[model samples]
Target: MNKLISVVAVVVGTAAALPASAQITSGSIAQNKAECQAQFRVSDLNGDNFLTPREISLFRGSMPTELSGREVIHRQDFISACYATLPQDD
Candidate 1:
């Protein structure tokens, strides 16, 4: 189920960001996922991949504009979706 969600997020994000004919290279995807992981790891504060309630609160405090503000992010699940959906620099 999580895998499916991740796939859908990737498809949606990619389609929203890229053209149908535009090829998404593996390196690009890997790089994007790495970046997302790094950012999340930093935001996690306690080094847990999952965001605690406090961590989530603080994250929303700082970035108060995203879906993370509205939903809890399990350590594993959001990483999967974000790495799949976000761009390399994101």
Candidate 2:
């Protein structure tokens, strides 16, 4: 009985260690984009193509959330900087 419980606990722990979906397997932009977009869309509280501070806050509030506030802010800052440097969206 003790051995069985230990085995079950290990299995549960290992399963919990896996990601929600195996889709976002790679960190590459192209590969992760679609998955991230899907997640962003579903998670985007304001329905904005871009995430707002509140929306991001809500995202952080939800579940097994990774990435610190600083990380999110830094990522948003970099993205904003890139967009600013872009030629045109039109």
TM-score of each: 0.44, 0.31
Error of 2 at 66 (Å): 12
Candidate 1 minimal-lDDT segment of 10 residues:
21-30
lDDT tens digits, residue span 1-90, model 1: 996586456544543454333433322332355555544544455554667776566445322233454455666765666655655552
Please report the TM-score between candidate 2 and the true structure.
0.31
Point to the candidate with the largest TM-score.
1
> lDDT for each of the candidates?
0.50, 0.40
Total clashes for model 1: 1
**lDDT, model 1, position 36:** 52
Worst-scoring 10-residue span by lDDT in model 2: 22-31
Q: For model 1, what is the error of residue 29's alpha carbon versus the real structure, in angstroms, after optimal superposition?
A: 14
In model 1, where do residues sit more than 4 Å from their true spots? Answer: 1-31, 61-72, 87-90
Residue pairs in collision within model 1: 50-75
